[model samples]
Target: MKYFCLRLLLQSVSWNAPLRTACSSQTLELKRMKLPSTFQESSKRFVHQVPATEFVAFTRSFHGTTMGALALTSEERFHEPFELVMPGVTFVQYGSIEEAKRTIRKGKTAAVFVEPVQGEGGIYTATKDFLQALRTFCDDAGALLVFDEV
Candidate 1:
């Protein structure tokens, strides 16, 4: 399953020439493999802990993109004072999407860190509309969207 997922992710990248062919052949090889039932079950359980789609997205965004600054939807609990996290990271409690949009625009935040479903902050889940708005805002502003599942 890990190999399958890796193949899919590699295919998504716009690689040139030999790299693309290599990934395609690797993907076909993985598809031909027949794993044991026990291994399949273990793969399913592992994916449940971190969904493949989310994991791929996080890794791609973190490694593939460059960001000048980071804006978090919520406050950092572990890092007191927050500035210790980095030089350009900031936390904002924008009650509305508009406010967040405005802040990100004005502050020129290169990325926004969000948790679709908050587990530590009382199990709060972000609305689909809010997430969508953030997506649009980031797209228009040329900023990366980062999700923190952990």
Candidate 2:
């Protein structure tokens, strides 16, 4: 009886192959439409070269939708099926220096990601204390502090 019940549950929770296919197609379309020029990519060396392991990006931050960029996104709605796609990214609440400090203290954090002015997370500005704490924590932890100016 347990085996039968488990089989039924598995069947009910099976993957939606069609939806997956459609989403993939749409993603390809979006990529083509949004691909920046090669010149533009080269113009910004900072964006091109940055080692982001467990980057601490804020919720609703906007970097891009490319797999690399998407990994930094904190919103579940934007990064649904791509949860472990980029692996090692740690998401945290936007505000609160205490939270940031605690998170940084976790160790193995490669980078402390933040926005000087968060545009996607509703145009919110980070507090001075929060930014200061982030800088100090990164310095103490030997982690790179990345400020998303975009």
**TM-score, per-candidate, Cα-based:** 0.45, 0.61
lDDT of 2: 0.52
Count steric clashes of candidate 2.
0
lDDT of 2 by residue, 5-25 (tens): 001111222232322232231
lDDT of 2 at 62: 62
- Which candidate tops lDDT? 2
lDDT of 2 at 71: 59
lDDT (tens digit, per residue) of candidate 1 on 50-95 = 3112111111111111111121223333232434433444444422
Query: What residue runs in model 1 are displaced by over 4 Å at the alpha carbon?
Result: 1-77, 81-85
